[model samples]
Target: MAKQYTKNLIKREFLKLLEEENFNNITIAMLAERCEISRNTFYYHYEDIYMLVREILRDELEKVDEEFNETFSWEESLLHAVSFLLKNKKAAQNLFRSIDKKEIDSYLYKICESVMSRYVDNECQSKTIDAKEYDKRLVTDFYRAALVGLLDKWIQDGMKESPDKVIFRIGKLFDGNIERSLRISENLDEA
Candidate 1:
């Protein structure tokens, strides 16, 4: 448990700094000082800022996935996942924006795809859909990309939507019957 404690401490300090300063402005000495650990101790656990951010992000995802049980629906899972990230918005914003890191997006995508893929495996339609698992992955992966890419765009656009508002819109985005959201095309008979 000592290792876990050290890891958590490092993550906590990293997050604290994120809230107060840009990620680029944050230094190892500042992190070590904030955490009340020596520079050596900080270096002992994490090789660099990027590694620490990645570890903390991956750990956060695992904790959230475990907390929610075997929730398989993409929309429901996204609500939970986004809620978690929104809870730590300052830190996340700093990590993503300052670090120019898409690992967070990629990490979230991997978690989402893993969960959704499992659900798909169990809900195989006829012999047809089940036989096309690769095709199914393609569709699911595309949808997953859209979900994450939209959020990235929103954040990169400087958070025009709060986490709550984004969550609400995402519900609409994935509520199915998406054709309704499109402008109806007018058909002209041959003149």
Candidate 2:
């Protein structure tokens, strides 16, 4: 219990620092100082700042994953994910400008993939579209990449636009698109 408490303390302090400083500028010593723990204690919980960042991201991803269910519309699921980035805008921007940007990209991609996969499956079943397994995968991957790319561009642009507007636009584009894609795939499979 104490061990978990210490680790959470380190994580909390690290996030606070991340919001105020560039990722490259933060050091283990600084994190340790902020956490009021010894350098060895920081090392005891994480190998380095990068590992700490990764663990934080993984935890957030798990939370998002657990909260998502079949009942959530794709837009809602995406908004839920984007809300995290918007809430942590400073830390996200700091990380995006750092060498660890790939981690953020990976996190977004996984979330997009998960959301798209479930949406596509549900849509196919509801529409009674008999898409092949491979086609379903292709559809999921296509939408996942598109969603990730959109979010990447939004982040790169400093996330100035409201998430709701961005999600609404994507929702407009997505309206009937999934069903259309499945129909095309189904026809291709039959041909």
Q: Name the candidate that leads on lDDT.
A: 2
lDDT of 2: 0.84
Q: Which stretches of candidate 2 lie over 4 Å from their true place?
A: 126-128
Query: Which digits, one per residue and each the tens of the lDDT, describe model 2 over residues 1-191?
Result: 99999989998888789899998889888888898999999988888887887888888888777887778788888888666788888988888778556776798898898788888888888778888888889889998898899888888898888777878787897688878988888778443
Candidate 1 global lDDT: 0.66
> How well is each residue in 1-191 modelled by candidate 1, as lDDT tens digits?
98789889888878888888998999899998888889998889999888898887777677655755443455566667666567777777777786644675686676566555544443443212323444555556766677667667766776656655665576576664222211111122222
